[model samples]
Target: MDFEELYQDIVLDHSRRPRNFGELAEAQFHAHGDNPNCGDEVTVHLKLGANDAIDALTFTGNGCSICMASASLMTLKMKHKSRAESGELIHAFHDMLTAEQESEPDKRLGDLRVFQSVRRFPQRVKCATLPWHALEEALGKPAGGEVSFSEDTAG
Candidate 1:
């Protein structure tokens, strides 16, 4: 099968049976993010080990298949990575999913590379990124997180 087909299968599988898909009762760090435009909301919980590695991570919420699958894959991929490494990964993933042109993904991104297709639809980008933003906040108490300004024009 072509890579897009395989990636689509991966997304479907992860969304239907998400890994680390529930709460983390022993979590040491946690945060929630919402994309009101798309109604994608997620809460990320993390437990850190010594030396700042992520010992465990999980999340809970509802949204599109892409959002759920992204959260699932994120938890799987970040299991033993240091917080610093996760931060780098966040930037890489954001860049990959938001790039305007078709581009090769970083090999280090592993299954995360599947999300490269998300770059095509600007609206869906927020669905795929909501959990990630929460994860950044979870990791950001020590490292400042970036502010995502909404376009709401209310005074």
Candidate 2:
């Protein structure tokens, strides 16, 4: 199959069998995010090391295939990474998902290139970004502003 087809398959497989689709029993940080447009919601849990590295990560949510799959993939990628590194990964992935110029590629995104197509669908952008936003919140960063989606949004 072609690259597009392979990417679709990967997304679907991850959605159907998400690798880190649950809460960590002893998480050091936690946060929630919601895509109000689609009602896709996710709660992310992170276990951090003394040095602020991610020792483990997990998530629980209900959303489209893209959202769930993206979260699963993000958890896998974040393991053993420092908060700073994970933040960089989040930026790289965001650039890959939203970049307009294919010529100026985000090399750090790696296999996350599969999400490059998501930029075309404005409504779906939130689905692809919910996890990263939640991660930021968990790290005590101000994601955007004091904007609230639902009281259901929490860490």
Q: Summarize candidate 2's per-residue lDDT along 88-151 as a digit string, tens digits.
A: 8888887776666654446666666677777666667778888887876776643422222332
**Model 2, CA-based lDDT:** 0.76
- Give the Å shift of residue 153 in candidate 2: 14
lDDT score of residue 89 within candidate 2: 86
Candidate of highest lDDT: 1
Clash pairs, model 1 backbone = none
What shift in Å separates residue 23 of candidate 1 from its native position after superposition?
1.0
Write one digit per residue (lDDT tens) for candidate 1, span 1-155.
Answer: 34364359899999999999888878887787777676677888888898889999999988889899999999999999997899988988988987666678778789889888777666677778878888888887664333333322221
Best by TM-score: 1
lDDT of 1 at 133: 81
Q: Would you give me the overall lDDT of model 1?
A: 0.81
